[model samples]
Target: MAPSDPVVDPISSRLDYDVGELRRAELAADPVAQLRRWLDDAGRAEVPEPNAMAVATVDADGRPRVRNVLLRNLDEAGLVFYSNRLSAKGQAIDANPVASALFSWLGLQRQARVDADVEVIDGDLADTYWANRPQGSQIASAASPQGEVVADRAELEALVERYERDAEGLDIPRPEHWVGYRLVPHTFEFWQGRRARLHDRFRYRLTGGSWEIDRLAP
Candidate 1:
């Protein structure tokens, strides 16, 4: 085979997406409500981790960074996800308090994008979610430093064991670093895959305290 010939070429293997459509009449006046509807549908369709969203942030150097995080709460306020305040993504959020998140339900051939301002929330809300977590997860969250380098797996296990021993006689309190962030969206785009790459897209943008919906070309 020639050097230019690839061993596994994916350029010609694109799948035609025709799973759904987005119509103006069917859209919710509020984008958040529309998002909730789509989320509920994804759950009913048994899409694994239906609440997972890829959150994108910009580092201090202006490079874009993206990582998947589970959506814990969603309402008119915003979308919430919890993480360590000192993690890489967290630092990025601190440096640049705006973020964009994408939710992809490939099985349904649908995707949603959210661009928003980030705000941290702690106090009772964080505590409530922390309390609902499994004991092992609590220990892990309190033990291992997220996005930090460790000597090895043994070092991490040791930290977990230490936390376990410390919490034997009492509750494992939530760490100060572990907190939730809410993304107050300024714009949202909902995409539905259609035949022949002519996907349907609708964008809801906040303008003058009201949402202005527009159709986007795929």
Candidate 2:
């Protein structure tokens, strides 16, 4: 917004947690394997939405934006997340395919960040994921223009209802714009909280055909 824009109510927020120290020997040599271990820990600890992550991308004008997306797939290939290709984020990815993703598991006193070049996943993969989506979500995907603003809530609701009714006896096809992006990260950073201000951090960089791990000063 411009400097002349009106302001809303001012507010502040903060939180502190009692977290355990992270040891260098506790991490896996392979960053992807380490990430998987941490994710499993998040699930075992019952941390809400263990697969939710923040995806960061740049707009056409060079402004950066971030949004929370479910981590659909992960492997040596990269991290995958699905979205409407026509949405603001998808459009941004089209214009600028490089992106970053972050997973913050505070309950586990851990966080992971990946920075990489991004691109749409194969059509077969997107098709499989779309077919497995819940029916209600498929309807919403069909009805919603994603980033487009609507004049009224009723209009959107009615559109969804129409799509649902039309697909009563048929499968809800994925919108043409609905697809996935894979982040082929060259760098991965994992952080673990500790007592006092001394936290532990490690970075894994893709070098040659293997990974090079380095400890970061906390």
* Top candidate when judged by lDDT against the true structure: 1
54 Cα displacement, candidate 2 (Å) = 0.5
Error of 2 at 24 (Å): 2.3
Stretches off by above 4 angstroms in model 2 are 1-18
Tens-digit lDDT string for candidate 2 (26-128)? 8788888988988998999999999999999998999999999999899999999999999999989998999989999988778899999998999999989
lDDT of 1 by residue, 43-107 (tens): 99999999999999998999999999999999889999999999999999999999999999999
- What ranges in model 1 sit over 4 Å off? 1-8
Task: Compute the lDDT for candidate 2.
Answer: 0.88
The superposed Cα distance between candidate 1 and the true structure at residue 185, in angstroms, equals 0.3
Models 1 onward score TM values of: 0.95, 0.90
